[model samples]
Target chain A: MGILEVKDVSKRFGGLKALSDVNLSVEEGTVHAIIGPNGAGKSTLLNCFVGKLIPDTGSVMFEGHSLLGIKPHQINQLGVSRVFQTPEIFSELTVFENVMIACFAKRDGSFRLQPFKTVENETDIVEKAEQMLVDVSMIEKRDMHSASLSRGDKRRLEMAMCLAQDPKLLLLDEPTAGMARADTNNTIELLKDIQKQRGITMAIIEHDMHVVFSLADRITVLAQGTPIVEDVPEKIKGHPKVQEAYLGTAH
Target chain B: MKILGLNEKDSRFLLIVIFLTLATPVLLQPFPEGSGMAQFNAGYPDLMQRFAIFGIFAIGFNILFGLTGYLSFGHAAFLGIGSYAVVWMYKLLDYNVIWGLPLAVVVSGIVALGIGFISLRRSGIYFSILTLAFAQMMFVISYSDLFGRFVGTTITNGETGLQVYGNDPQVLLGATEPSSPHFFGIVMRENFWTPQFGDWQFTFNNGYYFCAVIAILAFYLSLRIFRSPFGLMLRAIKTNQNRLNYTGVHSRPYTLAAFVISGMYAGLAGGLLAAMDPLAGAERMQWTESGTVVLMTILGGAGTLMGPVLGAGFIKYFENIFSKINDNVLHQWFAWMPDGLEDAIVWVLHFFVGKGWHLTLGVLFMLVVIFLPGGLVEGGTRIWRFIRGTDRKEKTADATHQPEHVAYVAEKEEF
Candidate 1:
């Protein structure tokens, strides 16, 4: 059994079918990339995994438990972390505080009314947060307000926050969607380094062919809300089905 | 060294707050008695006690609204509940204040829990409206004695207000016990000292000291909460509740906890108000009363440690001293000028003092909100930075170290 098992999951919104009978599993320590054309339900599938939306049918099992009928925070406490497309972060707080709150949530679980103990005195959590910032090459900007961070740096800070949680299964939805070439390359290297060091299981949804080929261990290509091909990157590079899905029947 | 588990900076801040609170009677009586400016002196027991009481109220309100960004418009219900609880305690037991104060806190906390659980389901304006609705319902109930009519007995005593009646049972009362509200045998209303120094006279009332001590404790507790991990989570809720939830932090419970804590703070203030004056009015639960604390928190500096206290003192000072300056007092001051010029001065000034005190407060609030979005604390910081001549230097220094993109982003976020 894989760490995350999504079997025969289907969802519909009014008359439109967003996902139909999708089945995928992320192995223990590998980068699983899901690539698809626009309007192919990539984000909808990712949302289903994080408890943001419930599938109309089938089961999403993490380890041995169901991921449905629970809150976003509860799913996170189950060792699953998701990075958003637009980088959802605490903009009013400092970079260090953004990571520290993640660390505190990881340690204290959803809710702990610790009104007396000072945040600076939590040496263990502080050490972990600072180390995460260093790993993301953001330690120098730790004191800077997260709102003032550049878009690329904001993405890095969000990565540091998720990493601070030490999640078992990391979900990335277009991690380099709107980045410059240099920023995208930096993010690719950062992910590669993190995967090599921690062996963290990641499931990335990407449209960038270069990023997918460089980072994905196993690639799943979906067309019209259904998987058209599931194979290694080398095979997916020359697949006729993926070509037809992306370039139309004229190809 | 740390005092009360606080760090050096926090401990120092607490010490300063305590010193200022305790020295209020002496400090407020700046002008000597029989002087022209003596009308502005607010060193009497009544006003000093009010400053401390309202200071505690604002500090607690800040913990919820300032930290979690949950603006509760019905906090006055808890305050009214506290007053009723204390007054009931006095009627049942003796006039000793010790029994009623703790009961007030407990009662208000329970009420807050019920209200917070329901109100926290909504965020932003919806949450505020829910709280306001609950408080309005409570006010109607208290004002018209709805519950009392149901029970066939006077509970809140309706419009006349709740007080210790002459024929009521005082089971804990002794023949020699003090008649009014007291801490054991010590009367809260009695003035312990009135020392005359040169032309100044300072009155140290037992009731004011009692309220001041509790206010100091409340301030210290708030300071600790501000530095705590829970406090960070609360701020995280304010900034981005979505991010907080994704980070595995439950925002609802944190907001609820803050609500209960602030309600308890309001309750304590209410109880103290009753202890000093021995009266509990239904008007204390009015929606306008709730709005006053919101104004205090925002006017002072919402999230800062000392801001609420300063805001409370400022408002209370103006309410008491400024409102006392009637047309006659204005005329007396302007009498030195020529008759026509004096009339002009007093006429213009009349709109800012006495019955028009709220107009002055409204104008000042507008200026603070417009020019200083961070409140009075921001104004103070700006003045301090100007005095030190470091604001311009820091901007230039930052421009050199940061990239142009970063500098642009920083400038955008400055406001």
Candidate 2:
């Protein structure tokens, strides 16, 4: 059995079927990529994996446990983390503070009411967050407000936040969607370095073919809420359905 | 040499500020006693009391507004419930503040939990409207004749206010006469202080000081919370609720927790107010009173640590000072001008001062909202930035760095 498995998951919004009979399996410690067009239900499927939206049918299993009825925060406790398309760093918080929260969440499960306690006292979590920041090359700007970071730096910080959680599975939804070409390249390199060093499994949603070709060990092409093809990067690059659904527009 | 990786200068500055704040009543005690100074002194303690009480109110409101970005319009009901609970304690078991205060807090907290759990199900404008509706319902119930017209829903004994005589047998300390409940030659006079320096006399009442200490503690607690991991999660929920959920963090429980904590803070403030004055009236729970806390938070800079206190002090000061000024004072100030012009000045002042102080308040609020959306703290920061000449570069850098396009796309993607 794969480390994470989704079997025939389907979701509907009113009359519109957002996802239909989608099936995929991700092995442990592999960089998996989901590439698709705008309305292909990539986000909906990601939402299902994290328990944000329960699928109409089918089951998502992480490790040996079923992820059907678990709450969203409970899912995070089970070692699954997701990064949004827009770098959702707390704009009002300092970079160090932003990562520190993630570290605390990972250590103490959600709903801790230790109001008088200090976050600085958690030496282990602090050390882990500091190490993650260094890995992402964000140590220099750690004191700066998260709002003040460059687009590329924001993505890196978001990645660091996810890393601080020490998750087994990291999900990224269009991690480099609105970044400039240079920033996009920087993010690709950062993700590649992190994957190699940490050996954490990641399932990324991407529109940029270059990022997909460079880092993906395996690729799944989603079109109109269905996984049309799932294969290695070389085979995915030349697949007829993927080309027609996604690459044709690019050409 | 850097402790916890924080700058020494910043740490030192913080230490000094905390020290000064803790020692304010003792350190700032030697100003003079003329009419002007006496007026300032007379206002100081009451202003300080308001600063703490309303500061608590706003801080609680901030948990909902600052963390979750949900504007609650029924927070005053919690405050009212707290005050009423204290009053009931005083009526049933004499003025034993120890019991009254804790009872008030517990009662208010339970009420807040019930209200917050139900209200948090809705989001955005609907949530705000729902809270407003509940507050109005509470106000109506409090004024309804079901509780008797003379007693109202919660009569405050004709506004003579409840008095804690300190002579009841049930009180922890031994019973004493109502007029002089002395312990070691110092009478337990709630409002007794006379600081005379030349022509200026400044008085700081014990009751007011008691309230001040509570307020300071509340402020410090709020500061700690703002720096906590839970606070960060609340802000994350505010910034993007969807993202928090997608990250396997349920937004509901976090938001509900913030709402309840804030409600408890409001309750504490209300209990303190009753402790100082020993009165609980239905009017305190009015929707307008709830709106006032929102005004304080917004006016002071909603998310900043000290902003709400400053906002509360500002509004309370104006309420006291401006309302005291009548047409006579206005006429006296404009007497030197030409008759027609002086009359005109008096007329305009009449429209804003005295009973019309709310008009002045309204205008001030509008100006603050339009010119300084971040409120008084932002205005002060802007002034400081102008003096330092470092604002322009920072603004430009901040503008350039934010991922606006990504935010826009994400917003569109939500549908």
Candidate 3:
């Protein structure tokens, strides 16, 4: 069985159907890419996975448990982590402190109150955060405020923060949305290196074809509110439906 | 190197608070009694008691507002609840403050838990409005004879407030009860060390010391909270609640915990107020009183360790000292000037001194909020950094290395 199973999951906002009968299964050890145009319900599906929304029908199962009727933190506790489109980081904190907070969240559960113990005393979490920063090549900028980092570096730091949680499944929502060419290439390489080193399962939503082609082990092209094609990158590039989906909308 | 799990800097801050609380009587009495400046001296026992009491209140308020960025507009409800609890305890029990204080804290905590449970369901302005509504409801319930008509008993004693009475049943005390609240024969109002040096006489009152010790403990507790992981989570809630939830941390419980703890602190302050003065009034629970605590935190620098206490002392000093300055005093200060000039000076100062202290406070609050967004502590940091900048300029001889962002200014202010 796959690690994640979403069967007949549908969501409707008032009279608009955001998702309809979406069935997606992500195998335990694959980089699955969800690619679609702007209004194609990609974020809605991602939000459904992380308990930000409850589908009007059907179920989402991560590992062996149902992910419905639970809080967002409870979803995170189930080894699912998400990187936002806008890098929703603690802008007021240092990079190290930011990653360290995630590490603490991973080490301790959603509601542990260590009111007397300082974060400095959590040596294991600190070491893990430092290690994650090194993996992301962000150790040099660890002391800098998270807000001071460039857009690309902020995404990298955000990735490091997610990695610090030791998530089993990482969800990326347009990770390379607003990066320069150099930064986007660097991010692809970094994400590729991380996948190779850690064998982490990532489900990325991307509009960037280059990033999708570089990192995705499996590609699912979504159109309107349903998946039109699921294939390898080579097959996906030459698919007739993809051409119609892209070319039909171009003019 | 650490006290109560706080780091060296935090420990030092708490130590300074403890030292200052202990030395308040001496430090406030800087001027000799016969000097003109003695009129500005804030060493009187009642004023000192107010300083300690309000310091505790503001520190408690800071835990919710400063750390979590939750602006509660009804925190004074807890204070009022605490005072009422204490007064009820004294009326039923004895003149001993020990019986009333603990009950006050417990009742206030329970009331806070109830209010917080309901209010925390909503955030931002909604949360603030909920708390305000609860406080207003309490005020309205206690203000008139609603309770007297319904329950056949006056719970808050209506508008005159709840207080210890003469003819009440004294099960805890024998025939005679002290005129004021006491702790096992230690009178709250009793003072000593009236030795005169020149015209200066510094009276050390038991009431002030009692309140001071508790306030110092409250400060230490708040300092500990500021350094703890829980405190970090509270700050994270302020920064981004969504991010915290995504990080596998529940934001509501953490914020609720902060709210309840801060409420208890307000309760403790209220209990201390009643312990010293033995009165509970609904006016103390007004939303405006809650605004005063917010002003203290913001004016002193919210989220800083000592800001709330400093802000509380500043406001209390202004309320007591500046409000005491009349046109006559302003005339005395300008006596050396020509008669017309002296009159002019007094007239100009009249808009700020004495009864116009509130206007002065309003202007000062606006200036601090506008120019120094981080409040008085931020201004101090700015001055400190300016001094440091000049010192570094002499050595570095180059301006390129100094980044011109507000990032450095904020990060460097922690120490």
Candidate 4:
């Protein structure tokens, strides 16, 4: 059994099968990428992993735990974290506060009702969040509002927020979908750095072939609600079926 | 603690604000009654009292609306339940406040838990409608004659409300008061000192001061919550519920906890209201009252620390001052205008202001929603920025950096 495994996971929406008989396995501490055209069921599969959607007939196991019926937060508690395609930061709050919340969650669980105390007083949590911010080069923008940051900076802050949780498996849905070339390169570098330092397994969904080639150790090509190709990035790039299914649409 | 990013300076600033607030009644003692200064004192304590009470209400509501983005329409029911509990305590027990207040808080919290559990199962407009229905049900129950037709939902016994005397044997012995009441206190006979000058006088009362102190404590408590990790989680809930869940934070418990905590604050406010006069009526839980708190939160600025207090003061000030203005007052102001023109203007003013203060409020609400969505705080910030010549500079800079169309396109693409 791999560190994370999905077996025959199928999801149907009304008459349309969003995901059908999809099987994939993620080895520990490797960067895995899922690439497909729009409506290729990449996001739906990610949703299933994070418990956002329940699969019709499948079992998702993470570190020996059954993730099928678990809630999203419960999945996070089980050493899994997800970053959405869009930057999701507390816009009104400062960058430091945004990361601090995630750190608090990792340390204190999800629900804490300490009324008279401040979270910053927690030394260990603060140190971890600060280190994560520094790693993402967001320490300078820590005091600025997350909403006021540039798109690249916002993504960095979001990455720091996810990292603060110290999850074993991180699921990223299109981390560089709308970013400029420079920002996308920066994100790729950040992901590389995180993988090197933390040795945490990552499952990233992306449409950009450049991002897939640069970062993914293993690439899975999904099309029409099924996995068409799953192999090393080099093999995935040359696959005839993946080219016919995905490259045809991209061109 | 400094761990959450709040340092000594911010805490000290809050301390000074609280100190000035608590000392206002004593510091303004020399101001003559009916004079502007004295009116400030006379009006402020009650207004500040509301600021604290409703601040708790809004903060609790904010937990739901701000964090979860779930707007509740029935929060007034929680407040009403709190008030009714306090009033019942006054009737059954003596007004020592030690037991009555805690009981009110606990009961209200329990009620909130029940309401939140049921309401949180739904999201968006459905959740708001569910809450509204619950609040209306509470209002109907309170107004129902099934409880007691003549006694009303809450009975003050007399206009003075429930009174306690030191001479009362049950109170002195720390026991529950008997059904039959007899004695009144000599303490009531002494007239408190009132400083007067010409047309104005400043009179101080112990009851008002007591409520004022409680209000200050509540305000300080809310300030703490606003800066706490719990508050951060609530904001995260508001910003992106799905993101929060994906990050492994269970949104339900956090939202429910916030609901309960806010309910307790409302309960404490209700207890104080009863303590000041010693009567709790079911009418306090009306949907209008719930809407009033929403108005207070939005009018202040939903997420800002001090916005609710400012909003509460603005609303209460309007209610007190605007309600007093009559047609004669309008006629006095516009007397210099030509007779026909003055009469027409007064007629029009009558439709918008004076007894029709709601019309003015409604217009103000629309203006705030459209022009100042951030409410009074944002408006004040805008004015400050304008005075500093930074507003134009900031907007131009923002405009050059990101075109509106591009941002919209980016947002649409993400969706």
lDDT of 3 by residue, A98-134 (tens): 8888988988899987777777777887799889999
Q: Arrange candidates, best TM-score first.
A: 1, 3, 2, 4
lDDT of 2 at A72: 68
Ranking by DockQ: 1, 3, 4, 2
- In model 2, the fraction of reference contacts reproduced equals 0.43
Which model scores highest in TM-score? 1
Worst 10 residues of 1 chain B by lDDT: B406-415
Steric overlap count per candidate: 0, 5, 0, 8
Kindly list the per-residue Cα lDDT of model 1 for residues B1-415, writing each as its tens digit: 6899888877787788889888999999999889999988989999999999999999999899888777899999999999999999999998999999999999999999999999888887778899999999999999999999999999999999999888989899999999999997889999999889999899999999999999988988988898899889988887778878888988888989999999999999999999998899999999999999988988887877777888888898888888888889989887889999999999999999998999999999999777776678767866887998865434322311121111100111100
lDDT tens digits, residue span B1-415, model 4 = 3322447755665676567656554554556554534433433344444544665566556545544456777878777666656656545555455556778789888988898889777766667788889888767766663344465543333323333434433433344433322112212112245555575444444445555566666666666675577767876766666667766677788778877777777777676666545556667777898888788777876666566667766777677667667788788789999999999999999977677988888888889867877677778867888888774445323221111111100111110
Sorted on lDDT, best first, the list reads 1, 3, 2, 4
Worst 10 residues of 2 chain B by lDDT: B403-412
lDDT of 2 by residue, A1-251 (tens): 77889999999999999999999999899999998999999999888887668999999999988887777678888998888788887775668867877777777776666655556666787898888889888898877777778888988888888888879999888988888999999999988988988899999988789999999999999999999999999998878888799756653
DockQ-based CAPRI category assigned to the predicted complex of candidate 3: medium
Q: lDDT tens string, model 3, B115-162? A: 998888888777888988998988887777477769898789888998
Give per-residue lDDT, candidate 2, residue B255: 76
TM-score of 1: 0.95
Candidate 4 regions exceeding 4 Å error are A247-251, B1-6, B23-69, B145-193, B197-199, B383-415
C-alpha DockQ of every model: 0.56, 0.34, 0.51, 0.46
